[model samples]
Target: MDDIFHFDTLLAGPPDQLLKAQEQERQRIAADLHDALGPLLTLIRLELGRASELVREDDLSDLAVVIGRAHGHVAQAFDELRRTVVNLRPAMLDDLGILPTLGWLVREFERCGSGLRIRTDFAVTEQAVPSHLKITIFRICQEALNNIVRHAQASHAALSLTLTDESLCLAIDDDGCGMPDNSHRGRGPAGGTSSIPQRATSSGGRCDITSGPGLGTRIHVCWPLAGIRP
Candidate 1:
């Protein structure tokens, strides 16, 4: 058994290899954004500025429509860029910790077309979690809330966080259509079961999804508190 374990270790290499690969991919994406998309956005901004100036000078009626369309396109491009950056890694989670960031997210979602009511309950204080753990919890909450908004058709949702002596728990619940199969676990279009679980595991946590035909879905996650840095 010892020899087999050693062989398996040799074949699998170190756990850090996966972390390194994820970091490398992150670096590659950052480089592409800076080198290619960044310059293209700058060029587009410059052209738009020049076109605005021309529209002002020409005073053509159709020029107003064209400039309006250009402005809308530019705004949309900026929104997409912002969304991409957030999805890559939420800056607010790193800067403000989980609670405040979650507050902001919930407020934003409430403002959207979905008339969902969100209730936030925090059993832990603001300083309860370390920075890394806070980020992890925040990301999980973001993912869960996003799923709710996209698929729930739910009228009400709740987000709750609790901390005990040994562990931290985060949960998001929605009163929308539940999962088709309570026993089966898989991913969905937005992010199937596999992806969400993988993310939670990567953050040293575990996630479980519970739902039924008429019963809404709830995502529950928990992580240990020992040695977690604030």
Candidate 2:
């Protein structure tokens, strides 16, 4: 049994090799979308606009109209494509770091007209959190807000990220309709049950969810920053 266990462990290679490969793939795809596809879309839009400009609207009304409609479709496609690229890997997260990216995310959620007012209090500087943990922290917060938008029919929400001597904590609170009685006993919200908590726990962190019928829901996550990275 011990020999078999050693052989299986050997087959697995370094545990981190798989994680490294995944991250590398993510980076490659993100770069291709941002650097290649984004510019190609812009070029197509410009070419269409230029083609339309060449045909005088008075002389070629029908052709111009066709080109204009095509331009509109291209515009919509470009916007959606940009959103997809952002979802895949937000440039703000890479350029601005986690705090600003989070603030931007809140503003975006508020813009959705979900009738949910979001307030943010990010007390920790980006330097305080280790680089490796920032993506996990951001993703957990993102998933939490997504749950609120989808499940919590709330009016007001608060997002706070604070760093203490012991840990870096993120808390999301919503004054929404809250969860069912069984939800408290269950894992989490339907879609987020695994993604949110597993992300925290995998990083040597912990997550807590407090919710009740008509009482709203609060999600708290804390990551002990010390010794998390080599």
Query: After superposition, which runs of candidate 1 have C-alpha atoms over 4 Å from their true positions?
Result: 1-80, 182-184, 188-194, 227-230
- What would the per-residue lDDT of candidate 1 be over residues 103-149, giving only the tens digit for each residue? 98899889988898999998998787666666667656766777777
RMSD (Cα, Å) of model 1: 8.4
How far residue 77's Cα lies from its native spot in candidate 1, in Å, is 4.9
Angstrom error of the Cα, residue 184, model 1: value is: 4.4
In the order shown, the candidates' Cα RMSDs to the true structure are 8.4, 9.4
> Candidate 2 lDDT (Cα, whole model)?
0.70
Q: Quote each prediction's TM-score.
A: 0.65, 0.68
Model 2 reaches what TM-score against the true structure? 0.68
Each candidate's lDDT (Cα)?
0.67, 0.70
